[model samples]
Target chain A: AQTVTQSQPEMSVQEAETVTLSCTYDTSESDYYLFWYKQPPSRQMILVIRQEAYKQQNATENRFSVNFQKAAKSFSLKISDSQLGDAAMYFCAYRKQYGNKLVFGAGTILRVKS
Target chain B: EAGVAQSPRYKIIEKRQSVAFWCNPISGHATLYWYQQILGQGPKLLIQFQNNGVVDDSQLPKDRFSAERLKGVDSTLKIQPAKLEDSAVYLCASSLDSGRLTDTQYFGPGTRLTVL
Candidate 1:
């Protein structure tokens, strides 16, 4: 079974600063997909960024980026120029290349301080 | 375009009571998923559907929980004699195509259930 682990249960970042959320996974399959999702107080899960295991170039979406190290099985999300809106419960998810099932990590609560 | 829709944003019931949740996926989406999220934890996939057919229900407690997507669009999940452990937020999501590697799943505002 594939499992995702998010080491940081809570993270604090100041506005206009940068913060990184740590994530690691254990998988025997080499081809898979990783994703970072943000859930605010409203309880809507929003996709922040995505990364394909086969791609070495990390995925970047605006102020959000992921440092995906396939060999080490580490996928961390970096939020730059952190804004108040970035405060949310962030989840790290994994899916096989040919599978629809998504396994998610416990989650990390991000707090943006002014 | 409108995102996924879920009815009854909040629900409360006793341990032995029955409750049901409704979900309407995004227009034209072929894949729909139901997830259960306990407080302070990540969402766990309960069931998945591909156009009215069940793709996966291994994690769903069939003895007490039931879900169906009859018309391939709208879905309903029911729990008979719900348990206090079942208290959680139920989330519905949809994807354009489950076969695509990059298909992104869009989620709806979850329905929070409180079972006492």
Candidate 2:
């Protein structure tokens, strides 16, 4: 079984500042994928970024980037130039390359302060 | 492209009652997923389907919950004798075939269920 863990329950960051949300996972599969999703109060789940285990280089989406350390089973999301729109519940997810089930972490509530 | 679609944005029912939710995946998506998201918690996979054929349902509570993707496009989930713990947001998501390692999933707005 694969499990994702987000140690932080909540995080706050000043607008335009940078913030990093930590995530860890336990998976026996050598090939898998990691993802970060954002859900605002509206309740829509939006994909923020994704990282492939085989790729040594991390994934980035404009202001969003990731620091993935496969050996340590660590994958953290970094949000640069955070804005008010970034305020939402963030989730860390894991999925095996050949599997369809996606395991998710408890989630972290991000609050962007102006 | 239109994202996943789920009906009944919110539902309120008493315990022991039956309820159902519907979902329509993206036009060409070959994989669909159903998840339960409890307040203050992350979403948990309830079931997954690949072109109307179930791929996984290990975590689903079969005793009271059932789901089907009859046509390989749209899906429905039903719960009978609902319990208080069944109160949660039900989300639907779709993605391209899992064979593509880079396939990303798109999610619906979700149906919020409250069992009284």
TM-score of each: 0.99, 0.98
Writing each residue's lDDT as its tens digit, candidate 2 over A14-57 gives: 99999999999998989999999999998999999998899999
**Predicted candidate 1 versus true structure: per-residue lDDT over B6-103, tens digit per residue:** 99999999999999999999999999999999998899999999999999999999999999999899999999989999999999999999988778
lDDT of each: 0.96, 0.94
**iRMSD, model 1, in Å:** 0.7
When just chain B is superposed on the true chain B, each candidate scores a TM-score of 0.98, 0.98
Clashes of 2: 0
lDDT of 1 by residue, A1-114 (tens): 999999999999999999999999999998999999999999999999989999999999999999999999999999999999999999999999996889999999999999
Whose DockQ is greatest here? 1
Tens-digit lDDT track for model 2 on B12-108?
A: 9999999999999999999999999998889999999999898899989999999999979999999998999999999999999877878888999
Output the lDDT of residue B48, model 2: 91
Candidate maximizing TM-score: 1
Docking class of 1: high
